[model samples]
Target chain A: MEITPTRVNFEFNPHVPIIMDSGIFKAIKSGGSSREQAIKSMYEDNKFRTQLSKYIAQNQGNEEDTKDIFQEALIILDKNLRNGKVDEDQNINAYLFKTCKLLWLNSLRKNNKIQLIDFEENPEELVTNEDLETFREEGKYKSLQKALTKLNDRCREILVLWSQSYSMKEIMKKLDLKSEAMARKSKHQCLLKLMQIIKSDPNGWED
Target chain B: MNESFYTELLEIKAQGKLNPEQEALLTSLIPQGSDLSSELKAYHLAKQAIEIDISNELKFKFNEWDQKKKSRLFRVDFKTISIAASLFLFLSVCSILWHSNQHFSNRRIVNDHLHKFNTEIRGVNSGPETLSDRIGKLRDGLEQNPTLVIQETQALLKLSVTGVQKDAIEWTLALAYLENNQNEKALTLLKSINANPDHSYQKHSKAVLDKLNSNWRVFLF
Candidate 1:
C-alpha cells in the first residue's frame, strides 16, 4: 500500500543556494509557533529530509544514522549556520549543503579521513557558543539509553522497578527479595553494575 | 572487610535508609564523591532500559560493520588509486587544453565581428535615445575594448561583494578597454547607463573609456 506523504520536508545541504519554495516558507512561519508548533511545522514545512536521507544512504548509512545526522545537523546549524555570517538567503538547499558539508568534513576529521589543519575556516566557527546544550542533552540521553541496554536481564528488571519509584516492600515481593533489606541490596548492586558499564565508556563524562 | 562493607553500602542505599555515620562511611568508600544515591538512580534507569531490550545496544538496522569492512578494503589500494587518479587527471588536462585551443580561434573570430559592429554603430544614433538604447550602446562600447571587456566579465563572475557594480558595470568594462587602448569598444560601453555606474575604475579610467572612439595612436599606452 502506498502512503502518500502529505507534506514537504528536506532540502539539500545549505551551501549551494538551491533556492527554497515560497509556499513551504509560509507554512513554516504559520501563526502561534511554539516548541510543539515547530515539531509539527517539520511536516508542513522544512523540505530537506529526502535529500539528507539519500545522502546518508548513499554513504552506506541507515535511517538511524540519518536521524543522528539530522539531529546533529540541526544543533550545529543552530549553533553555527546562522547570523548571515554565511551567504545565506532563502535558498534552503544551498544553506543545507554548506552546513552538511561542514558536518561531513568534521566527521571525516574525527574518523581520520581528513586533516584538521587550516584547510578552510571562519572565526565564528570557533567561538559560536560556550555551552552546547543540545549536544550535551543528546549525549546524556544517549548515554543513559545505551547503559540501560547493556544491563543483565535480572539487573535490568530490578532497575526498572526501582526507577518507577517502587518501594523496597513492593520490590521485595516482585523480585522475590527475602526482606526489604535484600531488595535494597540488589537494587544498589544493580545500579553499581550500570555505573561500571557507563564508567568504562565514559568519554566526556569524566572530569 | 570490603565485601560486607560494599554490600552494606548497597543495602543502605537500596532501602533508602542511612544513619549519618553509615552515609559518611559509604561516601568515603565510593571514589566518585558522595553521589552514591544518584549513581544508583542512574544505574536503575539503565537496568530498566536493558529489561526492555538488548537489541538496543547490539543491533543495527543495516549491516553497518560489514559495510565498514568493505570501505576498509578500499583503503588497501589507496596509493594505487591515487596514482591512477593523477594519471587520469593529467589526461583530462591534456584534453581540456586541446579543446581550449579550438575555442580560442572561435573567440578571436568573434572579437573581429564585434570590432566591425563597434565601427558601424558609432556612425548611427546621433542624439538623445531611449534608456534601453543607451544601455545597448554601452554594451557595444565595452565589447569593442578587449581589456575592459575581460575585466568586466571577470568581475561579473568573481562571486565577491564587489562584483555587483550597481549601474557602472559597463563603465568598468569601458575603463578596461580604455586601458588597453580599445577606444572603440570603450566608447560603446560608456553609452550604456548601467556601465557608467560601476565603481572600481578611476575618473581618469572613466574619461579614457569615454574618450572619442577614434583611430589615432593611444600614446598613453
Candidate 2:
C-alpha cells in the first residue's frame, strides 16, 4: 500500500522513530527490503530542482554557496540511501528532515562536520571542506568588486568586465592594454592590490 | 594589508581553494589595531545594511513558500521539501534568517485546537463526586461483556482513551458525539481511530483536526 502523510504515527511525535531506527540496526533486519529500496530511490530524486533553484535565486546569498549546501544535502541523501539506514515502515519525510538538519549543522561547523557523516568517499568528489571555505570567500568577492571602484575609471571598467568572464585577449583589445601578456599580468597585479584593500577591512568581507 | 598577503589570498580565494592552515593564517592576520578595527566596524555595519537589503528579497520568497505550504495538505512532496531545505541554506549563506511565520500559527493552531477541546469537554465537572460517579459506572461496565469496540469508539469520540478500535458501531456513537458538539468525546474516539494506522477516516480525522484548530471557527462557519 502507498503510505500517506496521515501514517506519520510510527510514534505520536515526528522525532521519535528517527531516534529509534537511525541506520545502525533495524533497517533490513529480516524480510522487509522492497520498502527500503523504494525509499532509497525516492530519497535521491532530483525532481525538486525547480523549487531548489527558485529558493536559491531569491535568497541574498551567492549562488555558489547555495550550490554547496544543496550538493552536501544530496551527498548525504545518497549515502543514507546506500546504507541500510532506512526501513520501509519508516517515515521518509522525517528522515529527510533529520538529514537536512545534520547537513546544515555541518555547513555551519567548518570542515569538522564532514567526518561525522559515516560514508565511503565518492571518487569524483573534489569539493571538500576547504573548497566550502573557498566558495564562501568567493561569495564575498563583492567586497573586491566594491573596492575596484576605488580605482580610476579605466581600472574599474577593466576589472569589472574581467570579473564578468571577459578573457585577457578581450580585455586587452577593449582596454587598449600595452600587450596581451602585459594586460594579463598587470590586470592580475591590479586585482591583487584591489583585493588587498578590501581584505584590509576583513571583518566586513567574511564569506 | 600588504600586496603579497592579499595576492596570496586572492590567488587561492579566486581558485576557491584553501586548506585549513591557509584559511587560519588569513583569518588570524586580519589586523585589529585601532584604525583597522574602526574600519572593520564600519564595514560590518555596511554589511548589515547590505544584508537588510537582501532580506527584503528573501522575505518575498518566504511568503511565497508559506502560501505553497498552506495549499499542500498531503505528504511533504520532493518539491516542497527541497525548497524548504534550499531556502534554509540560502538564508544561512546570506547570513540572514528566513524564519517561517508559521511558528506562531503552528503553535496557535495547536493551542487553539487543544483549547477548543478543553472548552467543549468542560469535563463532567472537575470534582471528585463526578469522577467517582463516572468511575463507578466505568467499573461496572468493565464487569459486563467487555464491549471493547464500543468502549474504544466512545473513547475515540471523546478524544480520550486514545488508540481505540474503529468499528462501525463505534463510529455511529462518535458521529453522535460530533453532532452534539461534544468535542471532547469526539476527540477521544478520534484518538482510538489512530490505532488502525491505515484507517479510511485518517484523512477525515486530520481535516477535522485542522478545522478544530481554527478556534471553533468551523462551528461558526
Q: Which candidate is the best by TM-score?
A: 1
- TM-score, B chain alone, candidates in order: 0.21, 0.24
Q: What are the per-model C-alpha RMSD values against the true structure?
A: 27.9, 28.3
Q: In candidate 1, what are the lDDT values of residues B1-221, reduced to their tens digit?
A: 44336645655566578888887777777755537755555444443344234222112312354366557878868878999999999999888766544433323323443454344333443332343244345556554555545664556535342322323344345445644656576556555532444433344344443334223223222
* Candidate with maximal DockQ: 1
Q: lDDT values of the candidates?
A: 0.49, 0.44
lDDT of 1: 0.49
How much is the lDDT of residue A175 in candidate 2?
Answer: 82
Q: How many residue pairs collide in each prediction?
A: 36, 18
Q: Candidate 1 on A74-145: residue-level lDDT in tens?
A: 433332332112233345445444455455544554455434444445565422333222333566557767
Model 2's CAPRI class is incorrect
> What are the TM-scores, per candidate, against the unseen true structure?
0.24, 0.23
lDDT at B186 for candidate 1? 53
User: Candidate 2 chain B, which ten residues in sequence have the lowest lDDT sum?
Assistant: B97-106
